[model samples]
Target chain A: MSSGYVPGLEGIVASQTAISMVDGENGRLVYQGYVIADLAEQMSFEEVAFLLWEGRLPNRSELDALSLELANHRTLTQAANITLDALPTDTDPMDVLRSVVSVQGVEHRLGKPSVPLAIHATASFPTILARFHRRQSGLDPIQPRADLGHAANYLYMMNGKESSPEVVRALNTYLVLLADHGMNASTFTARVIASTESDLISSLVGAIGALKGPAHGGAPAAVIEQLELIGTADNAERWMRDARKRKVKFMGFGHRVYRVYDPRAKILKEMCRRMNPKFYELATKVEEVALQILHEEHPERPQSTNVEFYSAGVLQAIGLPKGYFTPTFASARVAGWSAHVLEQAAHNRIIRPQSEYIGPEPRKPIPLAERV
Target chain B: MAEFSPGLEGVVAAETAVSEVDGANGRLIYRGGYLIEDLVPVVSFEEAAYLLWHGELPNESQLDALREQMATARTLNKSARGTLMAMDAATEPMDVLRTVVSAQGASKSLTKPSLDEAIALTAVFPTIVGAARRRGQGKAIVEPRADLGHAANLLWMMHGEEPAPEKVHLVDTYLVLLADHGLNASTFAARVVASTGSDLTSCVVGAIAALKGPAHGGATLAARNMLDKIGSAEDAEKWLREAHARHERFSGFGHRVYRTYDPRAKILREMAKTAAPDLHRTAARTEEVALAILHEAHPERPNATNVDFWASVVLTGAGIPKELFTTVFATSRVSGWTAHVLESLADLRIIRPASRWVGPEPGKKPLQLTKR
Candidate 1:
């Protein structure tokens, strides 16, 4: 009645969510029926998060309330703080989030997924990253500022002073753009965990793990690294061709969805061009050559620039260390992940897929003493 | 395009030689094509773990090498230790396992998943689980014993006494049996994380989060709790009948795979008689009634007792606390999780499945925050 094998589950539909949709043929992303283009520059991460959770944009009062709620929960739990301190100063921020979030989310036992828990978990991510970033840099960790909005507060905590409005707005748009992305691997991981009727933290924790992979959220850092190695626009062709010979993948160049340019990447690329001209110049040339070479190799495939490519330049402009790239991605995506978790929890089915076992036929076992 | 299959049921998401659950025939074949039944008596858990990673049965020297490798990696890293201490001892051990594993695997930078990292990750689990168990009892955390093998050391750390050979054999067999199964949810979660080119710890942490779901690794704990609720062999029929009348799904009675009896369950069912004889008697009767009731309701359903049904008893016999059952499952399954990650590295592709949009049509504009 069903197909046997679908490698990479290419065309399989694993979920049905009203949270977001990837209109791959049209190169659009929609959050609750609003095109990302309309929402990205206009919304704060908190309002978009509310839209994702409640299926509508929050009114001024509702937005204010939601912002306050997020602000209130931004500080880490004492145990979580202790756990954060326990980690090595040099530990990856993603790993710190994974562990500290677990400690922060620990309950006496399992509880059903809920909205408050999601909000709490989302708020903690920036704090965890900022604290660890400070610890790594040997700077004193700044307390979260309640007066600041989500993006501003994260900056304040990281730099110990409020950032300019432009930087905060840039980050806000970045978060809004990256907030949700249809049924991605990390979001699917969240849904899979939630489908088991597990707690929200469990789902969030699982999604974070999925995002840690370079194939998923790990590429933004690599994009910066690749650019650093290439040095300048003049070197793009030679460096990229040499990398191809060595089988060094061009990071952030492919997407399974999106026939045209990624909508998010289009927005990020603009921000990158304005904010980081040096990175933008080299990245643009690399993108041109890569697409041309890729097209020559496989004319049928739609291998275009993804969000991670220009995301490197924008994040670098915003002054996050390269190491924090994926973790920062997680901070934005946690909204999507939590929303997905809640969505899955509402009409849950245990997402246990069947495996076609291609192994030996059963036989009796020999005692160990008699084995060869 | 394939139609949406809820749960991705019957979707063969992967191809592998790690292990196979030949559900129709009730067989489990581990890597190297060794049948579960055949391998159980012939190999120790350590040897089986070696096989999963190396694709061959380890000879004595290899087994010893693996044992030595595991022993050296058994102690928790400073971060992991601090994280465990930071948690409330009364918190769910799975939460602790997830958090501490994340901490233990935390690094300054992301490293690709590797066999050495796998062994280190696997070795650290018993230490965390053992510590969590001790802390739960208001007892001091016990250190792992180098002289003890994996299963034996787990017991020694938990109880501060040498485990009996029979108990060790039962635990080891349980571990070996669960070492891998083709593309189960948790393993799929791990592979999905790895697909992102994430590190081994992140992959394993994700798997652990997925496993926390009640429908997956938590089944053993749920199965045991059900047995405790039913109380005794004499109470089995009445308890199950009432629970069935109320339409409550029995915890360990049904599986997605295994058209017949589960091979692991069958072996554990027999082992239960000698392992936890009293609980085994109760479980055996409970299984009989549950299966009968299940068959009567859905004549064509496989309706078989799964490994968790018997695993609960065996784990109990092995002196594992119920809270630690899921953590114990992680200890066994981490080897499988890491192995799948390593194998997938050879053919890494982002597992971003399509989602059929069920939301409102796009192109809606948002109102200003004040206007809204």
Candidate 2:
């Protein structure tokens, strides 16, 4: 007998993962045994990426090797460059990232998912977004500096100059916090593709597509848009009340997995307070009003503020355009996507789940010309 | 925590009317309650696609409108063209497809998936596949003719000549047979992406990436390669015996869903006799020997031939090169992928399944980097 259909597979355990765990009940995210709260501010994005790919923290030499490898692969391939230019100057940055990454990883033959391929993919995401951003602004693309760290190079490539230390650290912290989480939609998409034995780039490309959805990584940019519409902290309650009356969704207010406040949101909220007081002022007011309204509407639901809520402010403070929010999320999550691909490859199984057919019984068809 | 389903094997993730694989009874049913066998003789690939998308077989005028719509949408947009030209001729066709399709669908803003977009995406697969083929052969790319039907246009673009009527019939039948099949891995990938409220192009692109895997769409090419190695009917037994002794799994002999002969495989096997007589003879004999050897080894299993086995011969007869088999498979399955995505929109919910954490305990503190 088949199991009954579970809509959205909500709470279904699909895999056993050692790479990361989202402890939703406890509001904790753990990567390879270390709590996210402990690692968020201290670790470089490169170290978190390594920890995701390999199931342990890399030693100093190993970290240096990964950093160097990632830096070396920061430039786009010739094909990727042409493909990047092929898109219109006004195309969405996420679309540009998905398309160029597909071209950058094109191969003559199928290659198994490997750590080197993971590094290659993780390195290219920022470059693709930065190049497209520059092109959109009618500026020449900047070359990536190998001497800079992963987060620093991405900033350098986008602005054509090195960012201050505080800004680089904030971007690096954002990347580290978002590098991996257990069985999210985009990660699930990546693992699903990899379950079919597809290569890492294919998996990552598919993940990027899934992340572009409004329900997932796409929410962060919308959060920024909503705050801009709210205008000032003084008008937050009135605007939000009217928007709710019109059945408009409060972006970044809810999540399905986290029963409590998202741990990443907690960290990013503090970052916003320190780095972007202007955005933080309005965003905090919006968050407070949105939460109060939601609670009044559904008191049964637990308090929820997802990672995307404060992520908008942190990314804005780091000087990224709002359009680049989802693609930048892809840049961080590619490390986790590739790690999941390798794990799925190691424990190979074709993930062809059953579907309950609700169609009619089979019947004969009429001839084309004889139909009434 | 729920029990872990390694591959979600028996999990019912969705309820769909798009198509069904009743493996228990060996029946294949498409939308509108039409058996695949019943629909094949009376309809073209365009009609089958229309049925899948609109949930009914199109009437004469509706079919004509669909054909016109498809014909007009066959040409690649400028971005897609430039992206296609950017890739080397030696790149894999599937990689070309994944990239070009992404470029083709890149837009200024995210749009909801729609029927018009679905039809356009399905219509353009041949253009990308044909250009990839011509580029691989160092030949001039051929423009699609509006007068030709879907199957004929695909053949015409690939070969730079009008396709024979019989070959068109064979290809059309193949397309109809493969247009939809239950919750297949690639279709599931498409649905998973779509469930996040992503665009149709992203869903189709994700599906193409999954289909490139050897275990899914790539099985057809692998089947043809295996047959080529066996060479003739006389060598079937010896080659199979040696392979079985060496513990090599036969390329196209097993499937996860079917307990009996695949209905589509039965249809393709019959068509292969008329399409490629000599190869058909060799395939028939090889099938007999492979089945016996498999039965001897695993007497309890239902080791019947899959659709890929006979599809390889029929496609070969239709003059499709082995290298493009997977891409050709994507061409047929895009309709199904888009159909599934559209169906999922009525009750869209993010498919974020949970994962069991099997890593280290959560409270481990990290030592300073220099101490390591």
Candidate 1 per-residue lDDT, tens place, A102-218, comes to: 888998878988888889999999999999889888999999988899999998999988898999999999999999999999998888778766789988888888888777888
For candidate 1, the per-residue lDDT at B273 reads 89
| Residue-wise C-alpha lDDT for candidate 1, range B249-367, written one tens digit per residue | 89888778778888888888888888998998999899889989998999987788888989999999887888888989889999898888898888788788888888899988999
Candidate 1 ranges with C-alpha deviation above 4 Å: A241-247, A357-372
Lowest lDDT sum, 10 consecutive residues, model 2 chain A, at: A363-372
The numbered model that scores best in lDDT is 2
Interface RMSD of each: 1.8, 0.9
With a 3 Å backbone cut-off (N, CA, C), the pairs that clash in candidate 1 are A92-B107, A213-B196, A213-B198, A214-B196, A214-B197, A215-B196, A216-B196
| TM-score per model over all chains | 0.96, 0.99
lDDT of 2 by residue, B29-111 (tens): 99989988888889999989988998888878888999999999999999999999989999999999999999999999999
